[model samples]
Target: MELEFAQQFVRPILDKISSTPSSSELIIQDFAVIMIVASIMALISYKLKQPMIMAFIIAGMIIGPNTPPFSLITHVEILHVFAEIGIILLLFVIGMEFPIEKLKNVGKKATFIAVAEASGTFMAGFAVTQAMGFTFFDSLFVSLAISVTSTVIIMKVLEELGMIKDEATYLIVGIAVIEDIIIISLLAVLQSVASTGDLTINEVGMSIILVIAFIVGVIVLGSKIVPRCVDLVGKTNHSELLIIAVLGVAFGLSFIAFKLDISVATGAFFAGVLVAESKMRIATKIIATPIRDMFGALFFISVGALMDIKQLPLFIIPAVILIIVSFSAKFITVWAASRAQRLGKTTSLKTGIGLSSSGGELALVAAKGGADVGATSSFVLPMVGAMTIISTFISPYLIKYGWKLASRLESKGTGSSDTK
Candidate 1:
C-alpha cells in the first residue's frame, strides 16, 4: 500500500521537479527556510539550558523531508555540497583551535596513550563485529566508527561548564588529537580501497604511507605558505577578500583531497594544523568563526536529517550493548593514560568521560564510509545515533564525579600533611 501510494504521489512530485529546470530557485528557498529555522532554534535552545547544536539538530529533524507537518525542506544535491562545505570549515576551525605548544609539551606519552586507547577499543569493536558475522570490511568500519569519539562536542560541553582550561580538559584535548589522527589515517586507507575496488586489503600499507606522506607535506608547506597568503590578503584591508582567501585554502585543499579519494575533513584539519603555529592564525580564525558557526550548524542539521528513524528501535539493543562496551573500553584505557601522564585520578576520570561522549560528525563519517564500501547496512546510523544520545547525557555526570574525586583526594593529602 505504502509503495503504491509513494509511486503515485511522492514519485510524481520528484519526477516533476527533476524534469523542470526552473525549479532551481526552489532550492535556494529551501536552504533559506532551513537556515532561518536552525538559527532561531539554536538561540532558543541556549535559553533552555541546552547547547545550540542540539537545537539545530532537532530543528532539522522536524523540518526534514521525511517529516509531515513541516514540508519545507527538500533533499537536494546542492544541499549536500553545502553541507560538505560546512564540515570542512568546522574541521578547519578545530585545527586552528589546536595549540601546537601544548601538544609538544604533552609529547610522546600522550601519543602512546592515544594510540593504545584507540587501538584497543577498535580491536574490541572489530571483534564484536566479527562475532556477529560481519564481513572484514564491515567489521573494519564498525570498529573505527564505534571506537573514535567526537572531539568537538566534548570540548564544547567542557568549555560551557568552565572546565576548558583545567587538567581534565588538557588530557581530553590531547587524547582527542591522538584519536583523530588515527581514525583519519584509517579512513584514508579505507577510501583508497573502496574507490579502486581492486586495491585489496593487502594494499592498505601503501595507502597508509601515502596518507602519512600527505600529512607531512601539509605540515611543511601549510605553515610557511598559508599564513603568508592570509597576511597578504589581510594587508589588502578587505574583509571579504580575507574570507575568500580562507575559504579558498579550506575548500581548495579539500577538493584536492577529494580527487585523491581522501576525506574533505581530513584535508581541512591538516589545513588548520599547518597554519596553527602561524602568527596570523588568530586573525584567520576570528574572521572564519562566524562562517564556521553558520555552516557548521547546517552540517549537524544534515546529520539529523539523514537519520533513519524507522530503524532506530530495531538497532536499539545492539546500540546499547555497543555503547556500553565501547564507553567502558575507552574509559579505563584513557583514565589510565591520563593518570600515567600525571593528570591525577579525578582529572583522568573526567578526561575519560569526555573522550567517550561523541555524536554527529565522526560517527556519520564512519557510517557513510561503511555504506559506501558496501560493508554495512543502514543499521549503522541508528546504532550510532543511539550511542551519541546516551553519551551526550552521561558525560556531564561523569565529569562531575571526576571533579568530586579530585577534591576528596586533594583533601586527604592535605589532612595527612597536617597530621604529620
Candidate 2:
C-alpha cells in the first residue's frame, strides 16, 4: 500500500514533466529559441556591416524544418501567427513614416515614374520568360512576380544608408506604393483567370475600387475620430494604455482590410497615416518602436524559414536566369524612368541600381498565390524564394556603392577626354 501510494504520487509529476507539450507551449519555446539564435547572428551581421535582415534570415534557415536536426520548434503553424504580427507591425511602421503631406508633395512625379518603371519591368520580364519557353500563363505569373519591388527591403536599405532624405528616395518609395496596389490588383485578376479560365475585369476593378474607397474612408473618417480618441487616451498618461490604443488602431484596421479581401499591410499603412496626422504621432512611435522591431525580426526570420536551400539545386538554372534578367530589367527600366523625370544621370543610375532587386514579401506572396491557383508551375515559389535571398544580399551593397561607382566612371571618362 505504501509503495502503491508512492508510485501514484510520482507518476503524475513525471507525466507532467515529460508529457507532450501543448501547442501553445511549443510555440513559446520555439520563439525563445529563435530569438536566441537571431541575436547571435544579428551581432555577427552588425560587426560585418551587413543588414540585420540578412542575419535574421540566416538564423531562420539554421532553425528551419528543412535544415539539419529539423526545426527546433515543434509547431510551425503557431509560430506563423507571430510572423504575421511582425508583418503587420512592420507595415504599420512604414505607414507611420509616410504621412498625407509627404505623399501630396511627391504625388505627380512619383505617379509618372512609378507607372513607367513598373510597365517597363512587366514587359521585360514577360519577354524574358517567354523567350525561355515558359507557357504564356507561366510567363505572365513570373513577369508579375518580378515586376513589383520589395518595399520592405528597399525602405530598410535606404534608411540604413541614410538616403531617406534624398529626392530619389521619395520617388523610390512612391513607386513601391504604386506597385503594391498594382500587384494586389494583378493577383486578384490572376486568381480569377486561373479559377474561371477567363479574366473578369469587372470583379478585379470592383476589388480595386473597394480597396481605394476603404483607404479614403479610413483617412477621412479615421483622421477625425482617431485623434480625438488618442487625445482622451493620452490624458490618462498611461504609456501601456497608449501603446495598446495605437496597436488596436493598427491591427483593427488591418483586420478589416483582410476581411474585405484587401491587403492587410495596405490597411495597416493607412491606419498609420491616420495616427501620424495626430499630435500623438511621436509618442506613438516611441511606444511602438520596440514592439515593431521585435515582430519585424520575426518577419524576416520567417522569410528565411520559408527558404529550402536544398531545393535550390533543382531549380538553380531558372533561378539564376530569373535573377539576372529581373535585376537587369528593373535597373534599365527604373534608370530610364528617372531620366525621363529629369533626374541627373548619376542620380538616375543610382536609382536604377537601388530598385534593381526582386524578392520581397510581395514577390513571395504573389508566387504563393500563383502556385495555389495552379497558374504557375510547381517550381515558381522555390525559384522566387531563392531569387529573394540572392537579391536581399545584393540590394544593400548596390545602393551603398552605386553612386560612388558612377562618379568614378564619370571622372575617368572626363579625364580621358581632357587627355585627348
Candidate 3:
C-alpha cells in the first residue's frame, strides 16, 4: 500500500509538470525584449534627430533572427500579428482625421496625381528590372511593388517634421489615399494573374466593381449609421464604453474587408472616416492615439525584423537601382502633376519630395503574393524588403531638407519676379 501511494503521487507530479505551457511564457519574454530594445533605439534615434520609426526598425534588426547574436524574439509570428494590428490602428487614426468632406475637396486632383505617379513608377521599375535580366513575372511583381509609396512612412515623417499643417500636406495625404485604393485593386488583379498565369477581363472588371462598391457602401451607409451609433454610446458618458464601441467598429469593418478580399487597412481607414462624422470624434481620437502609437511601432519593428541582412548583399545592387528609379519616377510625376494643378512651386516641390520614398506594407503584400504563387524569383521579396528599409530610413531626411529646398526655390522665383 505504501509503495502504491508513492507511485500515484509521483505520477501526478510528473503529469502536472509536463502539462505546464511554455509558449505563453516565451511570448511574454519576446514582448519584453522587443519593448526594451525598441525603447533604447527610439531614444538613440531621437538624439540623432531621425524618425522614431527608423529607430524601431533598427532595434528590430538587432534583435531579429537575422542577427544571430541578438536574436531574442522566439515567436516571430506573434510579433507579425501585433504588427498587423498596428497597421490597422495607424490607418484608423488617420482616417478619423481625414473625413469625407475633406476627401471631396482634394478628390479630383489627388486622383490624377496618384494615377500618373503610379503609372510612371510602374513603367520605370518594369523597364529597369527587365534590363537587369529578371524574369517576366519577377519584373512585373517588382514593378508593381515599387509603384506605391509608403503611406505610413509619409504620414509619420510629415508629423515628425511639424509639416502636418502645410497646404502641401493636404494634397500629399489625398494622393496617398487614392494610391491606397488603386494599389488594393491592383493587388487583387496581380494575385489572380499569379495564381492562374493569366487575368481575364471579367476578373479585372469585377475587382474594380467590388472596390467601388465597398467604398461607396461604407461611406454612404456608414456615415449615416456609424455616427448615430457612436452618439448613442457617447450619451452613456462612459469613456471606456465609447472607446470599446469605436474599436469594435474599426475591427468589425476590417474583418468585413478581409472577407471581401479587400485590404484591412482600407477598411480600418474607412472606419475612422465614419467615426470622424460622429460628435465624439475628438474623444475617439484621443482614446485611439495611444493604441495607434503602440501598434504602429510594432508594425515598423516587424518590417525591420523581416529583413534578412545576410541576403541583402546579394540583392543590393539591383535593390539600389530599383530605389533610384522608383524615387526619381515618383518625384518627377508628383511634382509635374502638382504644378499642373496650380499648387504653387513650393507646394509642388514639397509634394514631390514627400511622395518620393517608395516601398511599404502594400509592397510587402505584393512581394508575398508573388512568393505564394511561386511566380517570382527568390530574390524578389528580399529585394523589396531591402528597398523598404532603406527608403524608410531616408524619408525623414528628404522631408526635412525638401522643405528647405522648396523654400529656397520660392524665394528665388520671388526675386526674379521682383527684378522683372
Give all candidate RMSDs, comma-separated: 7.5, 4.2, 4.4
> Quick one: how many clashes does candidate 2 have?
0
lDDT value for candidate 3?
A: 0.81
Q: What TM-score number comes out for model 2?
A: 0.83
lDDT of 1 by residue, 78-108 (tens): 5566668787898888777764565567667
Instruction: Indicate which candidate wins on TM-score.
Output: 1
Pairs with steric clashes in candidate 3: none
**Cα lDDT listed for each candidate:** 0.72, 0.75, 0.81
Query: What would the TM-score be for candidate 3 when compared with the true structure?
Result: 0.83
Query: What would the per-residue lDDT of candidate 3 be over residues 1-420, giving only the tens digit for each residue?
Result: 987987889878888678865998889989999999999999998898766766877787888887776678899988778876886797788789777887777678899999999988988998998899999889988998998888777788778778798888888888987786677556655655566665578776766677678888999999999999999999999999999999999999988977776667668888999999999999999988998899888877886787777887789999989999998999999988877776676777788998998877677666755765688977787688778778877776887788777777678785121221
Ranking under lDDT, best-scoring first?
A: 3, 2, 1
Model 1: ten consecutive residues of lowest lDDT = 411-420
What C-alpha lDDT, on a 0 to 100 scale, does residue 189 get in candidate 2? 56
| Candidate 1: clashing pairs of residues | none
Candidate 1: where are CA atoms >4 Å away?
A: 1-21, 68-71, 99-103, 160-162, 198-201, 339-344, 371-375, 409-420
